[model samples]
Target: MVKTNAMRMLDKAKIEYTTREYEVDEQNLSGSHAADMMGADHGCVFKTLVLKGEKMGYLVCCIPVDGELDLKKVAKAAGDKKVEMIPMKDLQKITGYIRGGCSPIGMKKQFPTFIEESARSYSEIVVSGGLRGQQIALQPQSLIGFVKGRFASLMQD
Candidate 1:
């Protein structure tokens, strides 16, 4: 398997992880679909979201594949009053990643990140491998710490 920026960083950090490969379907680019392709448990598969805050600039959140990001909650966690999703067209230019392939591990810049607290319940979780059709599975804490992210209540109520 070819190593992506995300996997390379994990190696440099000496963080142990395992990768899973799946076929990408452009029509169904959602993380839940990714998990289904990998035959992975949805609970352990996370999706990364990037949002812009009034004062905090850009921040990220990792929630379950089937979960929703609570904009208000994430903004509060990032010490911002409010937040909104970054437009799709700007994703690659801003983060050096396109949709369906962005990883929380390595971006154009390190933005404040948050993983839904529910991730803590699992010993390991799966996240994008920096490319569509690839996934990286590692301990939740390792992934969070590598990204300098916090675990918070980011899922929508």
Candidate 2:
């Protein structure tokens, strides 16, 4: 098993998660693309996004592969009047993970993290493993427990 900071964090928290690794394809590295590469259902895969809310400068937002993030709703959920997606250059500084490899767990700093309600419906959800070509699969509750993330309707219709 790769001992990434993410895995170490999960281990420290005693959160149960399984990691899978694949070859990095420079052409396709997004969550949806990774799901397709892994032959996993898109609904079961999630993407981690960082946003700057009106009140909150940096927050973690997790949405499913097929879902679109509603910036307005996310801002409201964060108790911010408005929200803007954080820039790629600022991602590592904020979350400690690169754009295509950010995960909800093991961030350099703990920020308010929110997961879409849809994630709770699945038995397991896949997320970036803190590195390209890797993903972690785990139960929603475990993820919530580890990250202490709030559940919200941050997804768009």
Candidate 3:
């Protein structure tokens, strides 16, 4: 099995997860879109977002496939006065992954991760497996264990 950073961390943390790979569709830019194309439940699909904290540079945000991220809420969740989405050039430079492939786990640095509080509503959630065309389905708690992410209403309404 080819392991991405997320998978490697899953192993190191002894978290149980199932890997799922879907075809890469150039037309999709959201998790719900990807899930529908892959025939997976949209509720269980999660999207990874990379944000910049004004001058702080980089942070990771995880929210449900159906949810939209609220930059204001994320700033509050990060306890920062302001937050902004990282530019594509910077995202690729820092994370070593293309726009659609960023994962909160195993970035160039271990960033503080924030997840949508609603994610706990699901038993298992799927996140990018650290690369395009792959995802991992694991218990939300196990994910929290590995990333130690804080839960908050950081998604957009």
Per-candidate TM-scores read: 0.98, 0.95, 0.91
RMSD of each: 0.7, 1.1, 1.6
Better of 1 and 3 by lDDT: 1
What does the lDDT come to for candidate 2? 0.86
lDDT for each residue of candidate 2 in 27-82, tens digit (9 for 90 to 100): 77777888888899998899999888766778888999878899888988899898
Write candidate 3's Cα lDDT for 1-157 as tens digits: 5689889888888889998887788777668777886788787788888888975557888888888789999988888889988877888788777867777777888777888888899988888888888888898888776777888888767
- Which residue pairs in candidate 1 have backbone atoms (N, alpha carbon, C) closer than 3 angstroms, thus clashing? none
Question: Candidate 2 or 3, higher lDDT?
Answer: 2
Candidate with top TM-score is 1
Candidate 1 lDDT? 0.93
**Model 1: lDDT of residue 113:** 89
Per-residue CA lDDT of candidate 1, range 43-143, in tens?
99999888999999998889999998888888889889989999999999989998999999889999998999999999999999999999999999999
User: What is the clash count for each candidate, in the order shown?
Assistant: 0, 0, 1
What's the residue-level lDDT of 31 in candidate 2?
A: 79
